[model samples]
Target: MKAPPFEYHRPSSLDEALGLLAELDEAKILAGGQSLLPLMSLRLGRPEHVVDIGDLGILDSLVVEPDGSVRVGALVTHRQVETSAEVAAHAPLLHAAAPMIGHRPIRTRGTVCGSIAHADPAAEMPAVALACNAAITAVSSRAAREIAAADFFEGYLQTVIEPDEIVTRVQFGPWPRHRRGAVVEQSRRSGDYAIIGLACWLDIEDNTITDAALSFFGVSDTPIRVAEAEDVLRGQAPTQSTFSAAGRTAAGVLRPTSDIHASANYRRHLAAVLTERGLAKATAESGETR
Candidate 1:
């Protein structure tokens, strides 16, 4: 299916893009267009105008700040994040999750900020952002503001982005040393959207968990940071029993919905199994578990 007829504007500058968005209330910003085009083709999204931000060179940059955080422009593709040395060194969790997004072609054309803005509950980046405590920068005609990952996602396919705002960059803090893990579920096909997924990071000291972040996707209205599970794991020496208990806690706390891909019960089971496996993998990777 082809997209509906719409006026297209290619803005060369960020200011120009902002002005266009401000002027056209029904305009949608086009970044990678991987998600937007699909929706448009299906007639799910009909905008009066399409504002293309592809030519804004500043939004295409990837910079590592002095504070060890990696700043990813909204236009950066999944492939870029997957292969970035700075991202790999500082935030391997993002690198690990990037390749799971989709096939090479889709990743090549999909933008990181676009995925977050689309807010697919099942996608990898949103969970990664939540787990890493990333910050998102949004710009509008009036002023710019930074939103933390926790507050950015409001519900399934919904976000805090106002109609006239554009997400410009995503800033991710360095992964805590001594912990990293990622897991996903798909049916016998690589690049398929996950039926369920999990990612975890742990900071360990003296054989005890110091800090931890655990995120889940494909089983909730939005990517969820399992705070109760994290709380159970923190300050505990990682043992088989502790891991098992934490997994159960996470499974019980999740509120999943039945869908075409999976039932709520099945997703809850996956959440438990994945949590145990992910935590174990993270602990081992961190060398916290012998």
Candidate 2:
């Protein structure tokens, strides 16, 4: 299948790209094209104008900002992010979650901001962003704003971003060195979309967990943060029984829908089982599990 014919604009500047997006109707911005191109090839997306921003060098950066956050530009490829030392040290959850997205070739061309903008409910990046409380920068010809990850994703494949706005950058705050991160995804096979995935981290001090994060994907319209489970695990010493109870709490509070890939009840079961295993794996990785 081939993409529908469209007027293509390769803008060399961010301002020019913004102008193209703002002025054109049904104009889609192309970053790495790992997500949009496939849909376009299948005629799932038919943009009248294709604004290619790949040459905008201003948006190709991958850096650790002065505020101790890892900032990824719209053009930074997944492979760059996956192998970044700054990402590994500052945002370990994202570092661990990167490889779970598709395969090496896809990651080599995929952009982080593009995936966030796509807002696939089953995607791992959203789960990592939600768990890390990441910040996203949105820009348009007229305005710019920063949106928190929690407020950015509205539903499955839907976001708060206006059609004219482009996701310019994504920033992830530094995770402490004492914190240990883990992402557990249940897919039928490697590189397949997860049936259910869990991304979590534990902050341990004095052999006791002071903080914990539990975010899930593939079970809802958006990444489900298991706040109830986090609350339960905050003060409790990590034991199999304690983790089990928290998993049950998470399963009870979640509202998952039945889909072709999995049933609601089956997803709920994965949520419970993965929650326990994810927490234990993260806690043990921190070397503070008692």
Candidate 3:
């Protein structure tokens, strides 16, 4: 299917792009076009104006800040995140989740900020952002603000971003060398959206779990951070039984909806399985025997 006819403006600068977004009614920002183009092609989204920010070099940076936090620009592709040594060392969870987004070709054209802005419940990037406590930067002609990950996503394919605002970057808090993270998911195929996905990490000291993050995707309207499960792991030794209990707790608290790809019960079961597996993997990566 062909996309509906729309006025396309290729803005050369961020200020020009912001002006276009603020001036046009029913305008859509196009960075990588991996998400918006598909919707437009399917006629699911029929914006009157398409503000293309592809040439805005200011939004194409991927920088590790002085404080060690990694800032991913709106135009930073998934492939760039996957291959970035700074991202791998500073934000291991983002690096680990990047390769799981889709196939290589898709990653090459898909932007990290675009995925987070899309707010798909089945997407991995949002869940990773949630687990890492990322701050999404939204810029408008009037002002700029940072939206916390917890407050950014509103519902399925929905976000708190105003129509005139563009998500310019996402800053993931630092994950030190001692902290370990992992991403695990169940999908129909290698590149398909996850049926149920888990992005988890552990902060361990002296072979005991000091803290843990359990963020689940494809289980609710938004990516959920299961505090109850994290509570179960805190202060406990990183052992099989502890992870299993946390897994059960996560499954018990979640209310996954039934879908054609997976039943509610099956999703719950996968959530439990992936939580356990992901925690164990992260613990092992941290070199904790207990």
Candidate 4:
């Protein structure tokens, strides 16, 4: 199906885009168009105006900050993050998670900020951002502000960003040398969306787990950090038993809804299995670095 009729505006500058957004009603920002276009074609989205920020030359940068965080601009594609040495060194989790996004063609066009703005519950970048403690920057004609990843997501395909505010950049960072992370997912196929996915991070010191972050996607309306499961891993040895316990704790607390692809109980089982697998991989990576 073709998308419904809508007026389109191609803004050449960020300020112009902001002005267009402020002046237009039911306006949608088009950065990468990986998610929005498809939804529009399916009649799921019916925006009256599409403010194309594609020509906004200012939003295409990927920079590493002085404090060790990687800032991904609104137009920085997943392929850029996948190939960036600065991102790989400073924010390894983002690097590790980049390649897992859909496929090469999708990565070539999909923007990190776009993904975060889209906030699909099954998307990898959102959960990765949550686990990395990333900060999202939102800008409007009136003011600019930063939103924590933990509070940015509200529900399935929902975020706290207002209609007039555009997400400019997302910063992922402060990855200490002692911190190790990994991402694992159980998809229907290689490039399909995950049936269940986990982004695991562990800070290990002297063969003991000092801190842990376990963020899961495809199990709820939003990517959730299971604090109860994380507490189970803290101060414990990075052992199979500990990981299994954490997995069980996460499964117990997760309340996933049934869908055509999977039942709620089946997803709970996947949650348990993937949690163990992801934590084990992260722990092994940490051990190797030590």
The candidate that achieves the highest lDDT relative to the unseen native structure: 3
Candidate 3 lDDT tens digits, 149-178: 999999999999999899999999867656
Q: Which stretches of candidate 4 lie over 4 Å from their true place?
A: 286-290
The deviation in Å at residue 51 for candidate 3 is 0.6
RMSD of each: 2.0, 2.0, 1.8, 1.4
TM-score on alpha carbons, each prediction: 0.95, 0.95, 0.97, 0.97
Indicate the TM-score of model 1: 0.95
Lowest-sum lDDT 10-residue window in model 1: 281-290
> Order of candidates by lDDT, top first?
3, 4, 2, 1
lDDT for predicted candidate 3 compared with the true structure = 0.92
Q: Per-residue lDDT tens digits of candidate 1, residues 90-120?
A: 7677778889988999999998889999999
* Model 2: per-residue Cα lDDT over 141-180, one tens digit each: 8899999998988998999999889899999986676788
- The runs of at least 3 residues in candidate 2 whose Cα sits more than 4 Å from the true structure, single-residue gaps closed, are 286-290
Model 1: how far residue 99 lies from native, Å: 0.2
RMSD of 1: 2.0
What lDDT score belongs to each candidate, Candidate 1 first? 0.86, 0.87, 0.92, 0.90
TM-score of 4: 0.97
Candidate 3: the clashing residue pairs are none
Tens digits of per-residue lDDT, candidate 4, 1-290, equal 79999999998888888898889999999888999999999999999999988887788889988987788999999999999877878888788889999899999999999998999999999999999879999999999999999999998899999998999999886788788788999888888888889998999889899999999999989998999999999999989999999999999999988988789999999999998999888767643321
Q: By lDDT, is 1 or 4 better?
A: 4
